[model samples]
Target: MEKTFKFTPEEFRTSVKIIQYLRTAIGSSLENHDEQKVRKYIHQAIVAGHVHRDVFGLNPILTSLQTAQIAVDEIGLHRDGVIATLLYGSVANDDDHEEIDQLFGENVARIVMGLAKIQKLYEKNPVIESENFRNLLLSFAEDMRVILIMIADRVNIMRQIRDVEQEEARHEVSEEASYLYAPLAHKLGLYGLKSELEDLSLKYLEHDAYYMIKEDLNATKKSRDAYIQQFIAPIQEKLTEAGLKFHMKGRTKSIHSIWQKMKKQKCGFKGIYDLFAIRIIIDSPYNLEKQLCWQAYSIVTDMYQPNPKRLRDWLSVPKSNGYESLHITVLGPESKWVEVQIRTERMDDIAEHGLAAHWRYKGIKSGGQMDEWLANIRAALEAGDNMEVMDNFKMTLAPEEMFVFTPKGDLFKFPAGATVLDFAYRIHSKIGNTCVGGRVNGKVVPMRQELHSGDSVEILTQSNQTPKHAWLSIVTTAKARAKIRLALKETQVKDGLYAKELLERRFKNKKIEIEESIMGHLVKKMGFKEVSDFYKQVSDGKLDPNDIIDKYVEIRNYQENHAKEHEARSAEEFEYEGPVEDLSSQSDDVLTIDQNLKGIDYHLASCCHPIYGDKIFGFVTAGGGIKIHRTDCPNAPEMRRRFGYRIVRARWSGKGTSQYSTTLKVIGNDDIGIISNITSIISKEEKILMRSINIDSHDGLFSGNLVVQLEDTTRLQALIKKLKMVKGVKQVQRI
Candidate 1:
């Protein structure tokens, strides 16, 4: 029996440290006490694999674990965020080890199952680019909380890969950072993770480029610090006035980002800007986020001229990841460019942890909040097909604010640009399919119309309306497109199978076996060179079997009347002797078969049998090899139609000078003196061509097979054709 692919439990001990670090780093709401359980469970997950304690538990992971612990000690994971963090990425690989699943439970197990679905999808059908797209979109649907935790997990993993010996490790870890991880981090609005991912990715992809940028950045360290201090000075004064508690810090751009810009823009150190940023972390509520932004803008612009275009008012419209911030770039002392980001405490938490911060939303029920997030994300995901994903995501997943009315003066929030169709689908797929259009402020409109922040949308659906192809054109979510395509493909297969069967039956009746087996042989024989080519011919009716055989033999072409000439009595059959030259004469056109040959049915007509150097035509006999005949033989006409394709225009050469047999047909009226006249013509002419002559008469009509000798078919036809126009001849042909 084959052994199961397994690794040791000690291998995952490091994962214990890594998961704990994540659990702690995420900080606070749901269940800090669960960390030990989560760690123990993951460690025991080694079914048939060895754990690399040092490999999985790296510095950043440990640091992240500490950060999560701080968050847990301070704010708490609320319920949803905790569940997501523990569950995501758990089911992707084989999980025969029982402890992890036993501890994580069904809720976490469900999320893992979702992740497993995506992994199995790609495993079954590998498409590198599509798989990435599919994984990203599907993760969005399973749970937003899960998405954030996985992003964090990836960030830590990148840091861990630094310890792997460089010789054999797959380069994709770093490559993934630059191409996929960083984009995901930025998309989630987790600037911290995004930056780390980029810096780490660049550190490996281009070591020299990263170091040079770092060195240059270090050179400006003091100035950058001083610049940040100056920008924060007025904020300090205001914070003191308002009695607000806050902390401030200065940070540098990630080496990856800096390196990317340097190479992409073809710039040196001087071209890069905003390498320094000021972060003002203020303790406040979500509503107070804008106040800090306004205050920070006032203080910064007062001291320095702000670039109007540099302003990003995300607080007015938080990102899809629940990120709220105010970003601006201004010209500081010495005209040096500087960037500043201001956000309240809750907003900061969400930025760092994304949906992970839902754990800290005061008074929010963890299960309800998580369920709501799952529902909304599922709404976004269940909207589009694979082809239109990026566009659909931009339209759905980008930060947009929706204003939905409640029954009693309340309003609900939705991602911006949500369509009536999205709303209907969000409500339920059945309603979405029935929804024909909707009203905004009591006016009818297309269902796909974008719902604005304050628009009171009332969806209208008709009872009889069915899904249309037009719906696919308007709907902008993966969820909608996938459902539509699945239905469409099912219907198409049903319809297509009918037509396929008809074609198959028609081919069957024609005795044409066009299946792979028969076509394979013909494909090889015809020298067409490709399987596709052969099938295409069979499908299109371009290939013919008889033609294939003729081509296979490389036979010469023949005249039309070749098959019928053998039935005529105008030629005689005889056996051949030594070299045909012994009996053959220039005027006697016929074929002589080798005497060593016996029981061959076809005979070269003595009147038209062609020997060496004679133009030929073939008379296909009822029994065998086509009898050689001259082109103009009288009886060659009917045979040409019956077997013209089978006829071969043959001519003998000195190489095959071995004896041959032939027959000649002589026809004349049965007058008393006709035979004597025919006999005398050849006998007196000193030609032994008239090997035999006979007379038969009924009502004075005449026909006879007169034996003669000459070359192959062509010369025979010429001689026989001339004999038909002879003064006393009724007709002449090869027998």
Candidate 2:
């Protein structure tokens, strides 16, 4: 008693078209599978009566089929990927997981399940906009094909977003595409999709800006085309005359890219001279691609006066995402700047479609540049925390990259603004953990030193030196930050365990039974969120176990006496309130002194230069005024022995706005730019005023003293740290 499935004429025609597309697009991938299976899946989708209708201008079943076609055609995903894409949404929504497993096997079912999880996450608004979107993408880490399908799905939506009627929904979708999906596409090296996503997003999110750029581009289209033709005519002739086979094409900048440039360069459309670029793609054998690219570059540069500063030789060292080309901005006929790009045919294909094209043309099962990139991303995700994951993802998405050299002349690429600590970690985690500083191009620099292109870095490590928690703030790379956090957590756990043992031993000595409830009560009373935090505080000597015992006894006594009234009283009523202090009228005091030192006219001692937050004491001067000195200051012991009567208690209380003069001493290897670097750091600080500077260089070493006026100890310490990071600087300390 089998039933026949009926299909409308239009549905039948659409199904036929999809079948034809799949047969042609995904040719041999379906050779082994029965043709009846595909028909059955399509029939089931049609019979279900669920349609995507509005957004994609097609039924959900057809949209899934089309997405699968795109995955096969564009990304070169395998048969299992295409089948999973085709059936995932419909089956998951219908809760037909077992049916999918029975029909397509467990592999396809697993992929569908993963995709269903992603859909579920998206439906539930987990966090804020960007973070939630990032999490949605990250959830597809298990199956790479799921990411491809999702990307294709978004691309399909973006393509049809113009027909979506809701303006607010369109704007939100556009923002998500621009901020999240586009970056994801770029990271995956799907350049064509990335560009389209960005362009479409700009059209919706910033219509006015988009239209303005479009109008400007249209207005200058005729002249710009003419100029491009005239400019490329000579270079094309030279490339052909050199016995090289090549093709030259002119490309106009996308509106989104133009808008970004306008904002970055702070210039209007008219000021942008190189709006169009000429790409000379050379045809070469597989073995001679680099050589042919360089040959084309030479020919193009020979025809024009290339701007030395504007030359970007990415062919020699390709970008981290596997982009390879030679770009140069040159002076043209009308004295205008013209951008020229030279690459081989292979490189041009990669430049257009990115990693997808690589996979398609190479005909390999992974194991290439893209694999390396994906491995790095996976490592970052596995090692990093939530925020670190986002940071690492953003770093991978960044367009700019800097190539720095090791001391042995090996080149390593890192994101711009990466510090020496990042470099050390990139080399090895051990090197980074033990690294105190580095020598950038033979000049000693702090671990926080930002590396630049062409700089040869030599790491300075010590056996005893370990990573500080401050290194987390110093590094820009996720690997270093994750390692530092992990190391710190391990240390904290060890200390916490030790503290727990110590507390348990003390409790035993006092014959007090320690229970989980008691420990929880103690932690809450001490204002700690967790027992481990309390233990850490105890291990750090900031908390006393005796205090906990006394509090426990006090609580027991109070509970025994007030058990009848405890339920009636509010939690606030039972809160511990110590004896109130007397609030008597006092004399008017304007000095920004510590709370303990009242009515004192105290200036910081010139010998010690104690600042805010320092453990300090007030010493009565011969002039009958007080001078503040740090408790650990070198002059403290002598002063305490000589003038014990003059000493008074002092501590930081209220904020201070008055500036104080301080002197700092810096030591480093000798370099002519040391003085300039020191002065630049000082000048950059708005709150710092330089009173004087003295620098002396001799025997490859330099010593400098800077007398500066600063507002407080915090700013002064920050300034000293900045000086330490400067090139050639070894140490910085207050005088």
Candidate 3:
């Protein structure tokens, strides 16, 4: 029996301040049916030591709880989310789903379960592809609150990473956070989280560089702060005089971002100026938000000499991630560069919290732009196989974006370096599959032509045109690659089916029955893993049907002659003493040598040499007593159709001791000593006895036929391998 501890009503009432703060932070949409119970859960979590002690030696439960609170609270999620955040780690560890369900309800339990699955996924496959990561996230798309929780958890981990002891673990965690989690945050419109994650990752990954930037910023903080105050003073006075309600604040650049600028500009810390940005948050009416942002932008530029080329008018057209801010870099006091941002309070919140803030402040439905973006991501993931999905994921995660247009004025966004084929596939898979080439801005361009922003693309398609293998290398988008591979595979399957039909017709004409065993041998002889591959080659005209038929005929003749000679010699020593057993029944059962027919010798036919494992039938020839032929022999159909009365059932009694003769064709470059090399290899194999060799040379290529004797198909295959390794040899195949 386990003791269950619970929080009392008095204990919950004492935490009213915390609950009220959460309620206000989360907005009016939040609801708590029993605030007492929610508070009690938090209290229990703290008492269980889940809040105070560090979970992963980086962040304590309290820190994660706060981060989760900020995440849900900013998004205006319901009260269950708040309770789950506090007890997520505790419930996860104790497997206390029943308690959570009974107290906080099933929704809270489900969210915690999703979080546990996410943690497990990350732990088991740390190096998972972006597509797989997206797929995992989308699995919980029905309840997107889980993803929000994960993002919050990641943010808290990065914030408290400094407390982590092992340098190696910190480096790994930071790299994953930077490369994987940061891009995800950015994609989700969590710009603040993205920037923070990037900065924290850079802090540990590039410690020396981080500290240098930090030390430089601190050393110049006094002068920087004074300069910012001087620059904002006039703008602040004018905005107030204009009756606009606003608050101006100075923000220093994050160390991670500062380092990025230094690297991108190829300069030292002193050479890099504008280490801070001044943000003006205006409190405007709902309808006047955009107008107030522009007004502030004008007031700020009027106070300083603004750089026209450095201005970003994102307020006019919000970024894809819903970021709305007007940025301008100006020459400030002391001739130093300074960046200023102008946005309304709503815009400011959206900028800080990204998608969550966008939804909460804008009052947009869940199925709007955010859903559309997620659908696109899901489409990309579903479009390709695992490897291709990963490639697409990386492409999607790329920060640099370009906007291209179709002939109909439809706008499309793609990563940098995406080509015309990628554009076609992005439009539709069918369009990409049939695309021959395209015109870019009224000029004919190859499908591989890299598109630029604002270019009008017109895809030129043909009905007969299908995706080519080379198109895979040309297209950069995951969707294009996946569609191309699928089309190619379909084509291969179609060709294989046609080849199979063609082979069947050829065998029928040659009076032979096609069998799986016969096709297996042919596939092995042609160096194919499966019969379908051989069929594809045949359908593509790479192999000759006549050559295959002739080889089968040759094998049948050899077996027939050998069987005739044995039957004649055995007849001299033995005489039948009883009625003959039913050959059909004897063939179906385990075959054994008949003592009564000891004198009447019979052997495997030369024409269709029946191996120990082969399905066979015996034919009594005019001179030979009986000849064994494989059921799928080239002559079996003719024998069965015409001389049906003469055919007798046959089966192999035991393994033969004698070697079997097989013919091999070797093709190679007509190099000097190439024939000698082939002969040398065959001679080296002690078990392989060479019967004859014939070589034909034409132009720069040579083809040779070598007849060799081996004990079994295994030895023959081994000999073929040895022959294939000879210098200048292109192919070695049993005919």
Candidate 4:
């Protein structure tokens, strides 16, 4: 007999009570059908007791329900977010994405999937400090609500894990809460949750310090209350006499913050002053909130002299994370300075709930600052360096914006320390490409000069200026760096092409045919990674063509001698003369084109000479047989446009079965021994055979057509690249 665990009658009742609570809480927010669906899932999760139990043996269903409640009441999420939180465990454990989408909608499915991915990420127990690890974590969270729900869920878990026996796991969770999630919450403007997370983490990780502070706060509770009441009595009377409707409270700083202050100031908890701040929340209409806040600021400053340096006026300009308030430090009744924060009801809500309240007040679907931040995330991911993405993400999380202006006085906001080049790219990529420098406040400055707040900037552009690889190091913004990298890559490709053409022209002039294998060995021995990199160096005039040719010849001779020695040994070991079958042309399988149709009568098109592994498509010829042409064939666009109905999608089914015939046109200076040099290279190549050569010589120029046979495009491209490296070859092209 096997033992089993089932929910007790009391546990089942507890779950039902939670469900009723959720029903009342979510009553008007969700449609009747949606509410029923959510309850149905909750009921199922409760009955499936095993699904709720973790290694700690806690009540799983209750945990999820409590998490959902936090998401609703604390995080201000509505139906879809609530539903995803309720079903996260079930969806993560089961592979029923279609069922989730069909029942709830695609949004719910996506959020659940993101949650599942993050759960998997946590299960790996990755090193928390790794940047790539953090990047992957953010990338997995495709939707912002996923992050919010996870934060809420983490808070619920933190609340419940205080008594768990697994001390090590508890400590790890607490450390993670401090390291990743708390900062995330703070970045999102959820100061309340941020403080809660930090306090709980400290309680678990620094038990002695946490309790010490807690006991001290408890001991000082009576005096603190008296002091707060005495301090606010006069201010409340003044505001009331001024005909303002408002409420005031003394907000204590978190235990973690107090501990931090003690460590920084090298003092005891009692020695730290300003442990609590008086927050005055005003009940004012939207238009008058700022005015009333200023009035309150003036009244308080008049009543008690305020420290001008300690005044913070965020009401004039809200933070990038949507935090707005007015803070002042004033001399109080006992000559002790106290911090006071004043804000309207709306501002207070945003300050308390972070982006959730901001989203609600602004209409959830509207494109606001948060949406722009999301777009920046997408762009950073596209830049393709995971570490860079993580850096940009961390910067954006708690971004401090500094305002700058264009020559025309158009205002722009950039992260602190942003450069003039960053501004140029933000204006337009074309401007960035041509930016020579900038004029900051009527003074010409280098492009890398950091812009100060309120500095007027005018970009200087020159047509001949282009993006250099060095620009990558100069720009601070991710957008500028990504665009500069793209421009440099494009320029490198064009330069490589030009160098290859010049090398081939030189090879044709020398009349030396090159061997790709020998040249590849030579390039590697010279410390190059790829042949194109070698070409780039050649375009930069870093290597002479004559020296490269000499090296190629030396390597070729050495390889030939090594091969002869092996052949001689093999011939002496086993001497059996027999006719060998030529199986090279044997076909492996017919091409499996698109549309699942096979065995079609088709041949490789001569116009493009497409080989195995080439991107291809089928064209019905006038003879009714299909012709396979490379997608990049010069004639493809014209054919597709002229005979749209005759074109069909196609691709190579497998590796090439046999060799292909191709033609190369060579042009060079009419120089002595050039033809011999070219013919010598072709005859020495083991895999390539020259079928024919037709030459025409005119004044100062030699042009020739050479036909060769090789297995596939890979070999054909190698052959062309080799021919391009000859000393006098000016041009090489496949015909």
Per-prediction TM-score, please?
Answer: 0.43, 0.51, 0.48, 0.52
Mind giving the per-residue lDDT tens digits that candidate 1 earns over 515-606? Answer: 43333454576777865554445444566545544442232122113323432332222222322345432233234344233333455576
lDDT of each: 0.55, 0.71, 0.68, 0.77
Alpha-carbon runs more than 4 Å astray in model 3: 1-64, 72-76, 92-103, 128-135, 138-141, 333-335, 359-368, 371-735
Model 2, range 295-351, lDDT digits (tens) per residue?
A: 877777777788999999887777766677899988888898888898888778878
Q: For candidate 4, which ten residues in a row score worst on lDDT?
A: 570-579
Indicate which candidate wins on TM-score.
4
Tens-digit lDDT string for candidate 3 (1-735): 113334447544534455566667654444455557766766676566554344344323455456656666544445555566766766536377778778766667766776665564454333432443454354433345666666677777776668767778778778878876777788777777888889888888888888888888889999887888888888889999989999999988788888888899999998777778899999987788888888777777778889999999986666766677899998877887888898888888878877656534433223445545544434432332133432333223324566666776555667779999999998998898899889987899989999865466899999998777888899887777898899899988898889878878999987887645445655686688877677777887989999877766665566445544443232112221322332221222233333224334465667655544556777888886777777888899999999998887665544544455667888877643566656667778875667666767676677777767655566777777777766457899865
Q: Tens digit of lDDT per residue, candidate 4, span 69-186?
A: 8877776666667788878875535465787888887767777887886675554345554433343444446565688888888898899898999999889889888888897788
lDDT of 3: 0.68
**What is the lDDT ranking, best to worst?**
4, 2, 3, 1
Q: What's every prediction's RMSD, in angstroms?
A: 24.0, 24.9, 26.4, 28.8
- Residue 641 in candidate 1, Cα distance off native in Å: 64
Summing lDDT over every window of 10 consecutive residues in candidate 1, give the lowest-scoring window. 384-393
| Cα RMSD of predicted structure 4 | 28.8
**Model with the higher lDDT, candidate 2 or 4:** 4
lDDT of 4: 0.77
Error of 1 at 576 (Å): 80
Ten contiguous residues with the weakest lDDT in model 2: 570-579
